[model samples]
Target: MAKNTTKNTEGQAPKGVRKPPATRKTAAQKKAEAEAKLKQQQLETGEGDNTPTDTPEQPNNEPTGETAEKEVTAGASESSAGQEGKTTETDKIKSDANPPVGNSTIEDLSDDEFDKGKRDGVSDDVEDQELMEGQMKLEDDGSTKIGDNPMLTDTKDKEEVQPFVRKTKIEKTSSNVSIKSLFKEWKKDQALRAKYRQEAEEAIKSGLPAPEFEDETTLRFDLAIQRNETWTDYQKSDLIHTVLYGYYLQPVLVEDSNDGKKWFIDGKQRLTTLMTFIEGQWALSKKTKPVYGYKIAGFKFNDLPSEMQDEIMDETITLVRIKNMTVAERDEMFVKQNSGTPLSKIELIRAMHSELSEQIDIELSSLKFFKEDLELTKKAKDKFIDVELILQIAMLIEEGKDRIKGLGADNYKEYVLRLKETEQIFSDEMIEKISNISNYLTLAFEDYEMDEVKKALKKVNVPIIFWTAITAMDDNLQPKLFGDFIRSFLISGYSVESAYGKSSQAGSSKKENVLIRLDEMSAALSQFIDMIRNASSIEEGVEQFNKHLADVNGVDREEGEDGERESA
Candidate 1:
């Protein structure tokens, strides 16, 4: 090996020397060399004409060649040893300045360069200083001179940079807040009324009509079509308590008539209670809590403080409106509205509007016999019991009790329906006949003074009395005689177990029972009328009937004693 000293001519290493491994440059040396090469190229081509040609160089500004490489390697080794697991500031800056290939840091790269880097798996850093300078120039002159990178240029010059506008949150005002909160604030601010008054005055001074606020509580009733009063005082008091306590109230239903009137379709009771209470017609119940530090129990609307009064007036009532409906449709709607609390059969019949129903309501119900003689309470009248009785009487008179099948509830409903379909007009003669019969009945009951008979006459026995009177008496029939005949017939039925008593006791509404009762009563009445015809006075006739009743009682007592002895 020592003898082989001949060198290879092509600059190859000598045989067996294994050419000492080539020196590898550190990252810093390579970066320095690349910068030197770029400077030399720029100088040779005169590309950087602004370079200071006469600038003096400083001593030891930088190392050169092998010495620079040696220094760079040694410095890198020292840095590597010192910062084994940490990155220095200078190293970080250098790393950021020279990002790895395919990194997303070079935003201003040309499309061609980007594509080439993508294909070659290499990326180069874009000089941020150059890009920033180009951007500043472009902004200054509104020109596109951002090097060769079209990505940095603004293509849409006409597009505006929209200024961000933040939405403002709405603040709750007194008018838009909850009613409870509004009332609370109103109570605290006692000057609210003065404020409103001042506003009204200003409005008037400005030649504008003073603000006329409509009261929501003011509602009208169509007396002919609306239902009668059915709510009791206790019910009204409960509603008043609900109002005082601020409980939710259901909305009132109304119909806007063609005549520009608002009529109540439903909620009559509720609306009326509210209106009456506000008008001081009734006092609040004991259940009402102290409102605004004042005990409102047993207090009228006038007794309340002005603030509480205003709160009641300011109470909001929702209204649902219907328009242009017929009576039948209204009736159907009323039934539907009151489905929860059902109406009575007679009430429902009355709701079915017809000329006859109207006559019963206006004429018949208003008659003295029905108004005074029936002895109906306000509640009974409100339930339409009077109307039902009067309607039944009228039907019997018109149909001639013999022609009617029965006077049960179902039969009565059918008759009402028939009346509606026919729109039957009752004649003056029929009406007069009914009135006379009613008058006779009233007078007869008043003069007879038989408590048991009179009591029976008020209820189911009324129709039988009417039938008997019509059958037995004529136009010239004396009231005294007629009264005497009725008294005798009732006494005979009461003193003995006769057909009248049996028929009147049970199944009274049955057709056969009604006929039997009528026949028995009419026969007795006929015989009494004939017996009284010869009598000199009503007293004499009554005396004779009493004697007859005594004889019948004597017979019954004898029979009862014999049966008692047999049992013993």
Candidate 2:
């Protein structure tokens, strides 16, 4: 029992078979695991990078696919959180009693990492070159020609004044910095950008050192403020109130100049507000609620307590300093930043692609109907509704109704692209034909100068009636009596109802609704035009036109019968 201690030498575990010391992890794998752990921690803490989740896909920059997935997933989640935060805050403050300070053009500057890429509100892929190209087409030479209107000044000269280059190669100014420290230092510099803000504020308080207009930013401000018509006093007050409440003031975008001053690319209005208020030129707005227990609305900056003034001074904001980009690039960026504003789709298109927009604008302006007749509301003007109407008609004539109808409101990206495609399809010959059609419409609506015709035209905002009729006409088949055609189709009660029905469909840009509306109008109007062209007399033409319209209306009512109730 005492003697089992001695084992045979062969019984010992074989050499090199001691289970290899648990296979120590390689340094590279350990490093990878550590990095992954750090990334997970960052994600959980919400301190990860905030670059746009929708940046164009490119070759993976990370060494491994797993890491790339982690970055993308984290970035997307972060963006969603920021978006939710903005929505919640916006809903809480958006009350009927408080007049809107400004359009949603303002961004909340608190989110330091938020990047408003092209087409901020529309969609993520808006910045794609192909997508942007679909917004509009520039002239072959990348310059626009003014239409043949003596009243319209040559815009080529204005184009010449723009910077030859649109963007600078970008470089980072800093990783991240608080607005309190950055502005405090930035203000002390005596360069043009800094000097102007300082002098403008001092001048407001002391009535000395009049502001100078040297740079584009200051020049634009001078043009707006000196004219005194661009923004009303109430608008100015409202903007001030919004900024004070920390709701939605977009960060000022700037680029550094050689003289150590930054050039303002956007946010002119917000900057002007801050400068004006600091100098005591404006008081707190009457409607603004005080922040941090400081209810000082209507109190001049000088009248506020020292601590309150300090609190305002120390308030931090995000300032984006982009180093290299062209002027055109900057303008587009400005458009994207302001996309949250209540701008119309066409307006956004104009900003996204200017050369083509200007070309379209000039051509539309040249039409006598637009120049001397069409009466657009101020809201319509802001939304570029007139431009959209003209573009829609022109595109429809060029590409047929199906293509136009397919471009729905929700498919804004596609709609813009199709409109841009019009430039390609509308050759010189096509343009001339369209122009001729416009001229014919002008003559048909000859009494457009009269208040009654003007009223009727305004009431029928859709231009499709003219488009449908004009497209359906034979090459040389002029109506036997153009005046009769106009009176019956445009100024008449039935014509008004048909056109206005399409206009009400503006609530949605859905493909189905758009197609239905356009299809109905085109069918009825084309038949009317053919009847007018073939009839021996105006009375006969009117009879046929009325009968066709009645039949078409009856058909439309019965067509969507799936939803109709059956009589008991």
**Local distance difference test, candidate 2:** 0.50
- Candidate 1, pairs of clashing residues: none
- Candidate 2 TM-score over all chains jointly: 0.42
Top lDDT hit: 1
Model 1: per-residue Cα lDDT over 1-568, one tens digit each: 5696676867588787787787987545555564565335433533223224685542443324333334334445667688554433333333334333433322334454443332223323332435333332223243434333566467646588899985533221112223344334334333555666787899999999888643222245644546788877668877766666678878767776545444677778887676667656888777666744667778887887787776666676666677656666777777788778988888777766545667766666777767776677778777877766766676677777568777777778888788777766456776777777878767766654445344545567777777666764574666656766655455432442556666776677788887887777676666566656668975786667645644543434343322211110
Candidate topping TM-score:
1
Q: Which stretches of candidate 1 lie over 4 Å from their true place?
A: 1-219, 285-297, 303-307, 425-429, 446-456, 491-497, 536-538, 553-568
Error of 2 at 245 (Å): 9.9
Q: How do the residues 251-343 of candidate 2 rate in per-residue lDDT, one tens digit apiece? A: 666655454555565556565566567767777667656766768667887787886566556665556777666545655666767666544
TM-score of each: 0.54, 0.42
List residue ranges in candidate 2 displaced over 4 A: 1-168, 171-235, 241-251, 254-265, 268-323, 326-332, 339-344, 365-368, 418-436, 449-463, 472-487, 490-568
